[model samples]
Target: MRPLTDQEMKVVLDKLANYMSDLKSLIAPLEDGDRYVFRLNHNRVYYVKLSLANLATCVGRDALLSLGTCLGKMTKSGKFRLHITALPILARGARHKIWVKENGAQPFLYGSNIVKAHVGRWSEDCPEHQGCVVYSMADIPLGFGVTARSTTEARRLDPTGIVCFRQADCGEYLRDEDTLFAG
Candidate 1:
């Protein structure tokens, strides 16, 4: 594993900023005392402590399956794709969020797009095509997706109109059990 290059860091930060407005606030907690660091292994970005990362260097690359929290992976085309596993971290700093109604929770968990009627509440400033975290009425993080319409536009949409397009949902853990963490 190796530290992310300047270019890689920029790509990762830009992608993360899509979900959260302040990149510094999102990354501040992870850099406390330089105790933690981000590393790249198998193209996957991991948030690991410095000591553990040092120890991991002794192990062969192929033998090391994982380390710390798997933030996501860098694609061949140089794009950073956020993974479902990073939900908790992202949710903590989410600028815009959508709260799904009880009846809509199940369908969202099933990987369906959120519809206008299913929205319990949402950040009023959420813009169309912007990334936002999805939550249950109880405030549980369910997933993240891009808004299909702005709050103003959605207010006039029919109940069946799509509000947010599903990108990745928590249900993938169960639906893709075998391959979820495969190398």
Candidate 2:
């Protein structure tokens, strides 16, 4: 990954602005601390690690590691895209949530798409391709997904098939996590 160009930075800033209104202010500090870009190919930044002065600025804080991290990708046309991680979603600031039961949540964390049958309830306004926080029945955030279909279409689809595409989940980063089940 590479540090985004000024134009690319503006695109990322606009996308994240919805969730983090103060994202631009963090850029200077991020540059000063430690800046490294993990890229998928040669142009897109997939993960970014940066520092922050206060824990309130981000989800995790450790003296040995940088905080205020984000996961993103570059579009085929070279536009930067950002997605929220499970850690930050747990902070309770996420706007869209797709609620699932234990059975569904388990598979989802293992990187399975949310089948229509397993979807219990969801934020009605969640649009396709937008990031949505996945919540367990108990209201704990399980991970994040990009909506594959609109609310109305999802409700109309066959219940046994996939609905939302999984992005990242708690299991991949947490232990006791059995690998994704073949079933």
Candidate 3:
């Protein structure tokens, strides 16, 4: 893993900015930090660790700061897909956040979706299949999810059903298993 070049930075930021709003504001400060690339089998993963604790505090003001990798992605096919990491979320915050109740936090941290009943708050205008940030009631981001139904349809459905499809979660990053490096 190594630092990204100017061209590489532009490519990544461009793709990420398209999906994440206010990305420019969040990533601008991070540009000065070191970015490392990890080639895992067929995927190219990139990550940037903020240089200081105050950087995260300035962004999200969260506690328990450590050697966490925020603002990371794995290249799929020829493009990059966002990996929900702590630092970036704390730094820039997601444009759309789906807040789930306490009962749902465990499931969500394990990559489960927010059922209609568990969903406490969601971006009202987020459409189906759009990527969104999933958070706990305390405002700590759990991971990423793709909206499964339109807001109107979701609201009309029963509370027991799933509202979004979980894509990634915090546990993946926190796990100590060798799966991440497995071939």
Candidate 4:
């Protein structure tokens, strides 16, 4: 319902940059027509078009449950947490990715961390602790998580070793139904 402050914008961009190598490339398409803009409402950040945002101004903040795509939410401690709703945008330009095997897909969707045995493949040169998107063998994005080891290090990890730490998963949309869309 309001524009993001300069500092807040920086934080959001920084968090996004963790998934994509180029920040401008990630944002260029959204701003292509100059019709889209980012807005903040009740700690949640939305990517909405200018025209819709203009119209939304006429509505009271309390009544505006949501607008556009919910990219993520700003936490109480000032950290930005990317939401599962942002999977499409993040997957498009993801710098590093981990593809889970068919048998592992169910567990990952259920919020379990990806184990080394379940890793079907991963981006080359992926570094330790880097943010990466998780996908199924069929190329469907299941979630996003942080790497537990570097590419080389993972090569020597045991089958039971944790490969990716779950951050957010698509299943949250159903599991968190009550609060996800609540204003």
Alpha-carbon runs more than 4 Å astray in model 3: 1-11, 27-73, 174-176, 181-183
Scored against the true structure, residue 61 in model 1 reaches a CA lDDT of 83
Candidate 1 residues lying further than 4 Å off, grouped into runs, are 29-34
- RMSD values for the candidates in order, in angstroms, are 1.7, 8.3, 8.0, 1.7
Q: Estimate, for each residue in 4-77, the C-alpha lDDT of model 4 and write its tens digit.
A: 99999999989998997766764454545655678999999998878789999999988899998899999999
CA lDDT of each prediction against the hidden true structure? 0.89, 0.60, 0.62, 0.90
* CA lDDT, candidate 4, residue 48: 81
Residue-level lDDT tens digits of model 2 in 1-183: 234677776676565544333443443445356653432323334344433223233533232232234455557786764433424622356657788877798889777899988888988876777667788878887777778888878888998867678877787655423322110
Q: Write the per-residue lDDT of candidate 3 for residues 155-178, one digit (tens) a residue.
A: 898988889888778787666234
Q: Per-residue error at 74 for model 4, in Å? A: 1.0
Off by more than 4 A, model 4: 29-32
List the candidates' TM-scores in order: 0.93, 0.59, 0.67, 0.94
- lDDT tens digits by residue: candidate 1, 50-79: 878999999998888889888888989999
Return the clash pairs for model 1, or none: none
Best by lDDT: 4
- Looking at model 2, report the run of 10 residues with the lowest lDDT sum: 174-183
In model 2, pairs of residues that clash are 1-39
* Model 4 local distance difference test score: 0.90
